[model samples]
Target: MVVMGSGGHTTEMLRITKHLNKERYTPRVYIVSSTDTTTISRVLAGEDSSGTYTICKIPRSREVKQSYLTSIFTTALSTVSSFPVVLWHRPQLVLCNGPGVCIPICAVVFLAKALFLIDARIVFVESLCRVKSFSLTGKILMFFADKILVQWPDLCKVSKRADYIGRL
Candidate 1:
């Protein structure tokens, strides 16, 4: 199962799923966020849908910016909601694209003893001369992920847990 922050990432993830060998692997997508209207409309809903995909909206207002009060409230609520979703799906493996949306859900998967794969790559290294705040999520991911994959070797350098998986 694949879980992520938003529809754009979901679209990219679906592209990755397209490469999987269907005979060996069946793909199911789960979107974890406050809402995924675009993903639900474009991918999760349709006559072609087989109900293989599901969406779980964490109970939080749609505010991208972080605040101490909102973070505590949302995190608590989302953490509470994550269990039933994990129990319902019981996926053998869970893949995550780095974001706050996946945090509580990944915790659920870990608590359920499911394997986790985290997509973590360092970006803007040359342009910005450093990894950004986005890359900090990689550190959090490394703590839980069974396998932490990085597109660049530079990212591997920062995270002791990462394996060089080639450029994404």
Candidate 2:
């Protein structure tokens, strides 16, 4: 499973997918924000749509510049709604970067893991832009993500949970 945010996040995901051996990762599931209009085209254009992937959308937990306090309610609601989606996909692994939508999906995956509904792993890669510090989503996921990969050595120092993977 691949979860993407808009713009740069989507671009990075598409770039990462180019290296995937589709034979090993069949029927890929991509999670994107419902409000994002551009990512779909980018996926269709850049990815091989040879019937090997599925795209799913969930509500965006918080918009850019959305108040942190109000985001609490929105994130909770999105997490609830994401349960069914996550259950349906039942991804063995969820790969995501910093994005509000990824939070709800990853949360559902964690909850499913706790409840023994399914065994899913989360691989979170901090964006290259986050050289000095983690984004809000990255900070929140640092504890829950099975693997926290950082593109820089500095970030690894900031969070022991993060491994310096060097620009991935």
Return the TM-score for each candidate structure: 0.73, 0.96
Best by TM-score: 2
Per-residue accuracy of model 2 over 1-168 as CA lDDT, tens digit each: 999899999887887787888888877888888889999888888667488888888888998899999999988888988998889989998999888899999888998999999898999989989999999889999767999988889998898899998876
- RMSD to the true structure for each prediction, in A, is 5.8, 1.1
Candidate 1 accuracy as lDDT: 0.55
Query: Weakest 10 consecutive residues, lDDT, candidate 2?
Result: 40-49
lDDT measured at residue 51 in model 1 versus the true structure, 0 to 100: 53
Residue 76 lDDT, candidate 1, scale 0-100: 76
Task: Give lDDT tens digits, candidate 1, residues 1-168.
Answer: 666555445555555555655444444645556655565554443214455456566653234777857687777777788777777766656766555666676666666663333232221111111232225445555656677665556765666666665534
Model 1: residue 56 alpha-carbon error in angstroms: 3.6
